[model samples]
Target: MAAPTADSASPADSTDPTNPADPTRPVLDCRGVWKTFGKGRDRTPVLRGIDLAVHEHEVVVLIGASGSGKSTLLRCVNLLERVDDGTIHLDGDDITDPRVNADAVRQRIGIVFQAFNLFPHLTVLDNITLAPRRVHRRARAEAEQAALDLLDRVGLAGKAREYPDRLSGGQQQRAAIVRALVNSPRLMLFDEVTSALDPELVGEVLALVSDLKGDGMTMVIATHEMGFARRVADRVCFLDRGVILEQGRPEQVLDNPAEPRTRQFLQRLLDTEPA
Candidate 1:
């Protein structure tokens, strides 16, 4: 698939993102956000004036080609990367502000990447309890109980005592997800989480995410899995060249896109699929 060019449409031209608003404030709100890497002549812009809002219990899926700023946007929202312009608000608090406590902000948000990133030496239980025990200052027994409960929920209760290397790719990723959830984050960010798993393993992870949606966990997922996106997303945002070119209900954006760029991108994904 082709990367969206800057000439396609400006952020000003995109549709409003507040279509699915509710009485409660959005869990995540990004306004005119921008991020650029490098300096001087080597500067490469990754995100440009991205405006998006993810309301409570809403699942917003971001779809675009590689380097279209999907991961970068998620990173920015997580406060791993600072925005060069604009602001990011989590639960109405401006987390982008310099005064904001990034670590504290992170405690409320959970982000899982394609890689499992579990510690090789730590058991699955240890991996899940590390953050809550150390950062949140929860007692060992309390943290362990919580971890075990979450592990059970994700079908990994028996594997809690097993080290990372002993588990399969699907189990490891689910372990990683359980680690993220053990913190009780108010919002979740999934960045191509199933990309590293085998085809057969992918469903288990997707099913877990579906269950999270059913539990009303607000999420912003960046994924190449269009079918999963269609099934899970409350709204689908077609990001192009660092801006949302189109967004609406899943069927509207994925099956009947209004923009030519959106249609072209979707067609490329369909063309690459195996018979």
Candidate 2:
């Protein structure tokens, strides 16, 4: 199947007005956020003054070129990489505060990266259960049961006993997603999760994400998949050189971007796709 052209109406279009999130208290809020790597002259800014608010059950998609800080913004939100300046609040709690427990904050959020990142030695069940059992102090039986249920939900019940290497790319990614879900996170962050998958395998993973959206999982996704973004996102933000240059509903931002840079970026993406 071909990707939707930029002008195509998103499946989410009709549902946009039905899913209004309260702007007063967002599930995730990033204000004046900045991240820079290296020291002194070697310093290179990755995120610059990122101000974004994701409401409960809202899916916000970040889109841009490779180095535009989409991944960095998600990493900072997950507390994987500490920001150099500014603050991030998850459900109004200041997660970026120096005194805040990072691990405790992480328990409220789940993130899946491009790579499956499943432990090779662990069976899929074990890989999925590790966090709940060890970190959350869940009972072994409870965690394993939860893992099995999620695996079943993702159509991977049979593969639960198998190792990551034994599964297809799609299966491994689904397991990673199930692992993320087992913790019952209030928010999920996806960073180019399907980029490593074969073209035919992308749909299964995207379908899983679509199911999550239907279930009202609040999510922040960083992706180059414009069609998927259009389909799933409540809002789309276009990042450029560490800044969000444009943001709006997918149709508004994708179909009729106000910024020249946004137009250029969308054009480049459209150019690379098969006609």
For model 2, how does the per-residue alpha-carbon lDDT over 22-117 read when each residue is reduced to its tens digit? 344667767678999989999999988877777788899999999999999999999999998877878768899889999999999999989989
The sequence of per-residue lDDT tens digits that candidate 1 reaches over residues 96-201 is 9999999999999999988989999899999999999999999999999999999999999999999999999999999999999999999999999999999999
Best by TM-score: 1
Compute the lDDT for candidate 1: 0.88
Worst 10 residues of 1 by lDDT: 1-10
TM-score of model number 2: 0.91
lDDT of each: 0.88, 0.87
Each candidate structure's TM-score, on Cα atoms with residue i matched to residue i, is 0.92, 0.91
Q: Which stretches of candidate 1 lie over 4 Å from their true place?
A: 1-24
lDDT of 2 at 246: 82
Error of 1 at 179 (Å): 0.4
In candidate 1, residue 53 scores what lDDT?
72
